[model samples]
Target: MNNLGFFKNPTQITYGMGAANQLREIIDAQGFKNVLIITDGGIVKTGLIDQLTRQLDGIHYAIFDETKPNPTVTNCDDAMLALKQINADVVVAMGGGSSIDVAKAVCLLATNGGSIAGYEGIDTCSNDLLPLVAIPTTAGTASEVTTFTVITDEERQYKLTVGGIRLAPKWALVDPLVTKSLPSHITASTGLDALVHALESYTSKMATPISKTLAREAIRKISSHLRQAVYNGDNMVARDNMLMGSLLAGLAFNNTRLGNCHALSHPVSAIYGVPHGVANSVLIPHVMEFNSLAVPELFSDIAEDMGENLESLTLMDRAVAAVDAVKKLSKDIGIPTTFAEFKVDDSQIDRMAKDAMLSGNIAANPRITTYEDVVALYRKSIGGALVEVV
Candidate 1:
């Protein structure tokens, strides 16, 4: 293990059941006059926007709710236009990862005076972004506290990953109550996404003591509470635990980066338009099976955290049990195990593998992955074949 490690999380996170009610006060304390609310049509339709507006009765704000599930550069450009038109001093993102990612792109463009494409890689943006306050209505992505934003480029047919400490939100208001109204599928997909994040980060080559601690706890919380949260959306305790799990997973990945699961899932979402969480959910077990060859001890630790009884198992067996546990949990939560469920076929596997290899995340994977390895994993994922790890 490397003795030298680095950790950085500049976002001030406030988490609780009713933490969102303090939004107005938080904004006031930040001394912001005009706030631009970036979210999606679903959030507006659900009356969450109205509820927030009511809380900020005297605050000056404008709403831009055109964000899509997989946000595009056009979405960021439109939001930037809205921010400029309203002359907002601060930006508030009040939805899932999409809204927050759009807001991050808009904020980056607002101050940096350029298109989102220019800031695609790590530390590409030198200027400080406009102050951003993220309030998550879903328990996944944890875009609220992370330093990464994924914006799709429709013209190029790719998802652009923007990273740097400069991209971290100024504040994260995590209210589990906000996730209480999420649909079951959303809960299941997002919760499983959180689980994948924990598992991938725990075994990442960049994993540190700090990140591993957070990742292990996140795995435990998601394993114990994700099902209850999905089955009973009204269960505040489960919702709270899932939200905390998501946040901790975000923190882990934010510091240490992720692994093959995320590296591969990005291309699937970019090409197939699959929801990020669902794609990750489907690919995680397959990636785990492949990655365990490089990190069996870490996978064994994950098996224990996932509630697997590995009493008499060898390290390799325990690692396989971890993959099995993830598969079982994903199936129990109604996440499709095969890419065929999303209508993906083998035609695009080669191109997707190439794109997946381009992700910086591939370098952080515990295993030294090749283009051929990625192609095999993609095939295994699409065929729903649980190949044994050598």
Candidate 2:
């Protein structure tokens, strides 16, 4: 129905259990020497790092396993220094979102000759980054397949989204088995994170028929499989479904972009050190309730997809039901109900709201929101925020 459009996905993706074992072959195909592997300390403890090293043994790699949970510009700088010291020609991201983000920033800075901050808004970088391969250990934060990276600035106390197509990995290896060992809390949190991605993408202003298709399917998969996956870590079927859900949600948001939920969630994560998915879970339902009127049909569609009854319910009721479904899911998975539970203070609301407004995700919100909206949302999302919002 539309004439003009553009789609940008540069990563060559390989997804499955045991897929990471092909690292040597993937690296050989890329034809690069002197690679840098980026990951977090937790992954280093998981023995996957040893497997990765074994697969690519004697293949010229320097490990920089310091990608903190909320990766910062300082983290990237440190990784960059390490990469430069070793003269790495390729970057291998070997963990979840934080590791992938660090690798992306380092890869760009290696050739671009500047800090990660220099490439903040959009496709401002003209140079291509070093060939990078992403191995995601979590079923959430599909950072491996997307062009966006969130980096916190400690001095400024703001989480900024650094985006550019050049930041997309040259290859993405999504192996479900890597996620099997994640704790139940982590599985639940990341599963909710994937749900937020799907919901946000579905409600984004950039939503197209194609993106909606992916988003709806992602939502279905997460809703169906998340509880089982969280409860039974050994269930390969549940893990696989969660991974697929995460990947499809990544595909949807990568193209359609996200909205105000992500906008508000980023500040919470960056400032209070809340887990990324937990933060998103806290804000998503609030933002959804706020924006429900702006896009009722989309929300209604989501309600139907979540198996909520809409036969007698009005559009507003359906939207409310959708919000309730998200809240229920969060509760079932043991996600804390509010910012106060995360030890965030009431006085910090203004600072959080101010920073949230600066997130690029706000631009894609279906409804226009200002600082006031963000503040009110934060206020409503403190201890026991869910009941208050509903």
Candidate 3:
């Protein structure tokens, strides 16, 4: 790091107990026309979309509620078509990352006039996307605050990113109340995902002092609140803190990209159809273990942030405890510790490893990563027939 460090979070975040209800006022203030509310069917069934529409007394809006997990370019096309059908000028994404990612791509395609595949790399688009207002119903993903959107490209068998300041949501309405109805498993997985964000950003080679501070606090809050939030979803304090923690993590990683866990998990989820957070949950402990060699003291700090006590242990032992702490958290939250539970096909390892190394995230990892390192990590994460990476 030099005397000058960079920290950027472009989204205007409005967080409170009832922050989601302010959507109508924001839309009206902006004079946005024909709002397109993008979300998954689950959120539609939750009646959240209705709740949103009820607040918009006379706003013309349409709902595209077919966003799938690890949203694809196809989903973006569908959403763009829906936006075109209504000629919507603004978009309101009111679900997890999938819906928000689809909306971001739609915004890009609406203005840029190209397939989402063309804008796969960082800062690849020149034009500004459509006006976007993100309301995150889950504590994880934090797409509401991030400048990156991961869209699965089925043809490539990869999770493609369209990232830049232009992709950031104009506003993030983070209402903990919107998260009160989340099922326990979702609360767990999403919260765990937030933890991984903080962990990776905290130790990222690109981390700045500002990102580290936010990541550290995020780790502390998530470690303390996630278990309670998962087991007792109705607890408002736990929900609120989890949401806040997730927001902080998003803001942190928005500047400093995540490490091997995110890099590795993308291919796992794309290949096996495992949920993003669950795949990350299984890979995080291993990533921590691998990264500990590069920054042992940082790992120790992570352990302390996660509420683990070193109690006069060796320096290396303290670092190892960080990996242990992550594993314990996953087990306690019912996240699978291995890929076997997901029926991951080991024969896919070579292709997956190649794809994993292709991630831009690998450059930000604290450790010097090689294609061979990614192959080994996959073998360790997926303990099966383990065809040698050719």
Candidate 1: tens digits of C-alpha lDDT, residues 1-390: 565499888999999978888888887788888889999998898888888888777778899999999999888999999999989999999999999999999999988988898789999987999999999999899999999999998887899899999899999999998898899999999999988889888998888999999999999999999999989999999999999999999999998889888888988898889999999988898889888988899999999998999999999999999999998999899998887767887777877888889999999999999988998998888884333322
Candidate with more favorable, higher TM-score: 1 or 3: 3
List of clashing residue pairs for candidate 2 = none
**Could you arrange the candidates by TM-score from highest to lowest?**
3, 1, 2
Give lDDT per model, in order: 0.90, 0.86, 0.90
Clashes per candidate (backbone, < 3 Å): 0, 0, 0
lDDT of 3 by residue, 224-331 (tens): 999999999999999999999999999999999999999999998887889988999988987888999999999999988988889989888899988999899899
Better of 2 and 3 by TM-score: 3
Provide TM-scores for the models. 0.97, 0.95, 0.98
Residue range 1-390, candidate 2, lDDT tens digits:
742245567888898888888789987787777888999888989888888899776688889988898999999999999998889988899988899999999988898888887787888788888888999988889998999888998887788787878878989888898888888998998889999999999888887877888899999999988998999999999999899989989988998889988888888887889989999888888899899989988888888888887899988888888988889889999998777667887767777777888877888999999877887888778843321211
Error of 1 at 309 (Å): 1.0
Which candidate leads the pack in TM-score? 3
TM-score for candidate 1, residues paired by index: 0.97
Off by over 4 Å in 3: 1-4
The TM-score of candidate 3 is: 0.98
Q: What lDDT is obtained when candidate 1 is compared to the true structure? A: 0.90
